[model samples]
Target: MATKNNVVAFQYPRLTKENYDKWSLIMKTVLGAQGFWENVEKGYTEHDVAVMLNQSQKEASQNERKKDKNALMVIHQGLDDDMFKKVANATSSKQAWDTLQKFFEGVSRVKKVRLQNLRGEFKKLEMLDKKSISDYFGRVLNIVNQMKRLGESMQDCRVVEKILHSVNSDFNHVVVVIEELNKDLESMTIDELSGSLQAHEQ
Candidate 1:
């Protein structure tokens, strides 16, 4: 079995015809870690921002150039033939990155609309009669996870508040007491809330 990782890497999502948001967000982080994000964000030849590469990269040492190649290689690894073909003509890593950006510019709006729908679904979710706290949380997290996948910046406080508000009447007293005593809802985690609620149930 694979050993557990303490520092989990951001998953490198593959460039797909329909998933530009996920792919670009993760790929940008991976590239950023290697110091090539600057070149990609601001081209090598274009030096308005000369933080990474300067003046057509005339100032770039061989080591910096190699880093650029490594960044390009990683981008290629995450692409399929069709996607790669679009960036094939790009000489610099930035050129390749920009080509894909232009291709997926329309996806940003679609992601927002999908996230709006998820918000509605989450608000409508509730704990049903006879459902364990664990089970109810599972339902809540399903929608939460989907929103997160679409780049929603969901906070723990919001999730905790939603759970407390939507719990069955069986948990009404406990939810009231929890909200009253734990005024700092932002600091309360789902695990802490669930454990408290489950203890009350038992």
Candidate 2:
């Protein structure tokens, strides 16, 4: 820990007077220590600040783009937990496919937002699940497949995560219904056959 007074004071035991002078000269040539405080005091104008902000925004956008692209690569490699979960818990084969579709659409919209930002297009962002589950899922699949073809990063889409459990429940219900239906049909057929046999005997 350095004391406040010692913060600006630095000394070297190994440095000779001549070596210190030479180091100073080299530092002056390599570093902008010469005008350091003087230039800083001059400061920047509001316009200059704005320009800097714009440039920073651009840099941030570029970085985001690169990150998104890399993320897309990871997505392309395989299905993530969210996607797998959605597929596994699908109420029906159709629902599972629909879930995939919506997820991809969300990803595309996110990419589009990034691109729009980069292009300086300032538009209000709409919520992803602005539509009904069925419609949204359809749209989502459309977007997902499109992005998938283009190659983008994908992750566990929390969008449908909440509904996954419900979908699973529905699937189980369907299974139960089918089983019940089969049992009921079998019982009815047996009863029908017995009644007809008794009637023939009478």
**Model 2 root mean square deviation, Cα atoms:** 26.1
- RMSD of candidate 1 to the truth, in angstroms, is 10.8
Best by lDDT: 1
In candidate 2, what are the lDDT values of residues 82-115, reduced to their tens digit? Answer: 4466456543323433455566667667767655
Residues forming the 10-long window of minimal summed lDDT in candidate 2: 37-46
Candidate maximizing TM-score: 1
Off by over 4 Å in 1: 1-82, 86-102
Clash total of candidate 2: 10
Candidate 2 Cα misplacement greater than 4 A, ranges: 1-82, 121-202
**Model 1 Cα lDDT, one tens digit per residue, 1-202:** 1235666554456789777778889888888887888767766543355466555565556556677777888889789999899999887788889888877775677878999999999989989899999999899998999999987888989999999999999999999999999999999998899899989989
Which ten residues in a row are the worst by lDDT in model 1?
1-10
Model 1 lDDT, full chain set? 0.84
